[model samples]
Target: MTRPTRVDDLPIRDELRGQHAYGAPQLDVPVRLNTNENPHPLPEALVARIAERVTEAARGLNRYPDRDAVELRTRLAEYLSRGGVPIAPAQVWAANGSNEVIQQLLQAFGGPGRLALGFDPSYSMHALISRGTGTAWLSGPRRADFTVDVEAARAALAEHRPHVVFLCSPNNPTGTAIEPETVLAVYEAAQAARPSLVVVDEAYVEFSHGRSLLELLDGRPNLVITRTMSKAFGAAGLRLGYLAADPAVVEALLLVRLPYHLSSVTQATALAALEHTDTLLGYVEQLKAERDRVAAALAALGLEVVPSDANFIQFGRFADADAAWRTLLDQGVLVRDNGLPGWLRVSIGTEAENDAFLAAVKSVDVVTKKEQQ
Candidate 1:
């Protein structure tokens, strides 16, 4: 056997080693409850509208898109406020997607000497991004239930004085929403320190009962709320993301944004997607329904599941989550295995998909019992 050049060997940071992310199986299996994606596809009417708009915009492909992405930002400002978080068009800006939005936040706030503080066992991608940029990374202990630790977070803000502090509500993997008051406490202290950005990564806001901080926009120049069309809008392919903040912060993002960041096709497709906002919302309700129903069924199977406000559920304490993950895959079901040892995350799928996952778990239970003999 000969050794091939590793991706890490190509003049990259030591962090970029052979070890990679643990992702859900992306197969077209009988059921897929992984990656926290909406099980439903965009409605037919909306899909048709997107097609028409994209074709119409194709004629103008030679022309560059608006670097400022004027109309889309206006639409988002209005959409984000539909629930709460009232924001004006002038205060909003968007990028390729929220992942990019997070990176942009880091670029604008983080640098050589500056540190970035966020909760541990939260979004693993945050650690990856912060580490890649050579910024000092600091972590706060999350509560046992995975909610953001208010006192701990505040202390880190005071101690490290990190340039950026990330708060992911209805956070990833754990699927728990940090209380708004808990997040605000960090904001109050971070603002007093000058030039710190508190980003509320509300990537899964549609399913949450608690409203976004969009309405709390005014007076706090340091606050930024991040959102995405990928999750609720069924526009994952569109690579669209938006950030709400003061005009000054929005302007800074524009400066660093790749020129004409929003493609004409992307804008046209996104605008079309917005036209059927109700269709997407209906899907949200369906997924919420599935989340509750499936969680109950899993509990009945003797699995302990974390209380979730988002689309996914985290469950386990089995001796091995990886083996359980393999069992699901064997039965043609797939889910996300998380950072927490002995825990796996399952996204809410359709009725049929839910049934398939249940069946798989049933088989696993029977097998474990037999092994006891």
Candidate 2:
């Protein structure tokens, strides 16, 4: 007997390169609400600043960017301070994106027989990344409303004794945050039973009425908050995201990361992004206003709209959400279909775009998709 050749001879992990990681599509779509990206464009002034800085770095491309982006770290620490979660530059570390940042956290703390844990219907990336690290991932069951069950979470913690726990506030897909007390309880349970790192992925926090657990981090050394410029800041294309944790923990991450993990051009762009925090935050306010409007409209139309604290709304009562997802795409108003088979997730775009999506929904007899299917 002999092993198969070529593709068949490759490692299973290598074979997974072209496969879906978190069910996100890479195709170009007119309305891309499916990816939870901010619809706002980068401000002109900020663009100019980024251009100036990137041009300055053109001559330095022959050499690597600072293995540690010290200037960017200072800006990020100041940014976090303004948001009420005070931090220092020494406490922050970043990678290409929050996706990779989380991967670093996993590599430092999880893999093999070790376990990674999270709550159900939360960020799918948590489970995807955990498996990519060769770690066993477990989750507590979700409630009827799709939030995690606190008691179930405590039990899961006791059982899995996970090395890392990903807690996504204003959790993806469902669009509701885990309550503060709920998060606190989980932290206490984990600390009592085992040493675990609890990471709060606050990637969408700016759009969520400014509520964050970063304030709870001082005494909770085991907890960390990860942020991304991809959401409300409209920097997804640049792929910049960071982690804020104790210096000791940050040192652990720094030990394993590659030199020049973020390019000089990328660093220049992020530095410019920090300068426009106020302008970008104004956009977040606009999105929150739109989020409320969309939720109310969906409720009026007899859909069960989840009370969302994030920039998107999740509605129940679809006859077939998958078909509706395709219909929305055909109409150039793409949104995610989640929360079981008969629910949909719609991102809050600019008013004009939101109007177009709402009108498209009203025009369609959604049941038609089911009939055709």
Candidate 3:
């Protein structure tokens, strides 16, 4: 039998014909911060408990894992409730990652004839997943500073009346968050046009200065809030993402999710992490301070830094962002050139790692690159 030599040799979906996969380039650099990951590792106590829990779960490998993920969802609800919004496990849903959670949402609420919309320069996955699920995507506008303009957003929602609307707080690449009023404005406009689902992607909310929007979920049945353990929980490898919404929304997702989609080992590992939530959260507080310090230092370097609410800062006005990005990579430092002209983003890392990144940038002649070009 002969193996296919190229992707074109096989029968692939028309939409996926020439599309590139979504991801930052994972390069081996001394200071890697391209992806917005928690730079800390799980504490030893948590690691040990994970081993113990997985051992217990291994005994049940013969049977299927819990299809509903009741315990995990219950714990997630409790975590969100600590922000002052009481939630029941029935109001929650879980998946492999927040990306999968978003995909499942598009599958359930968006389709071939449906439409989905998101503010531009936000999460790219919102559009990619919509296309994959056969939902038409609409790009909304944001201000030059990267904040969503209230009137502009309302107009877009009223005009499109998309089946699903995505709002990312502490939005990716820009690191700017949305105000509660903006959410309300968009939600009201969407309802005015048509009864639609408003999805607030709060994957980075755990690191923000203010409270979680979970409180808003109380009266807004059309709203959904998605969270993940990947960033603040420092469990990117664990791949556990969950959502809080009305019980009916949770029930709706069940129809679209694959049977036993989550593995027993993932459940065991995430449960162990939850047991150490306090210890893990301490690390988040420290990172928040570091993030602020990084922002100040970047400003001191004469770079324009966007005010960040997440564990990353977006800073640049470079003449050639791609050239500057290559310069950083040459210094054994890695940052993201998110293709937003003249801009780049750097994830907050450990103190030493951050120092190295700062030093690398200092060594590069920021003005010289533009002059050279």
**Among these predicted structures, which one has the highest lDDT?**
3
RMSD of each: 2.2, 3.1, 1.8
Clashes per candidate (backbone, < 3 Å): 4, 0, 1
Greater-TM-score candidate between 1 and 2:
1
Worst 10 residues of 2 by lDDT: 363-372
Task: Output the worst ten-in-a-row residue range by lDDT, candidate 3.
Answer: 363-372
Backbone steric clashes in candidate 2, count: 0
lDDT for residue 48 in candidate 3, whole number 0-100: 93
User: What does the lDDT read for residue 109 in candidate 2?
Assistant: 88
Better of 1 and 2 by lDDT: 2
lDDT of 2 by residue, 1-373 (tens): 8855754346776424454646755556666676777889998999999999899988799999988999999999998898667898988988888999999898888878788888777788888888888877887677888877888888888877888888888888778877789889888888877989999999888877547777888888788889999997889899999988888888998776877788999998899889999999899888899889988887776568888878788875667677777777788877786546778888888898888878777644456444646
Query: Could you give candidate 1's per-residue lDDT for residues 238-273 as a string of tens digits?
Result: 788888899888878766677887788888888898
- In candidate 2 the C-alpha lDDT for residue 30 amounts to 63
lDDT, residue 59, model 3: 100
Candidate 1: minimum summed lDDT over ten consecutive residues — where? 15-24
Candidate 3 runs further than 4 Å off? 1-10, 368-373
TM-score preference between candidates 1 and 3, better one: 3
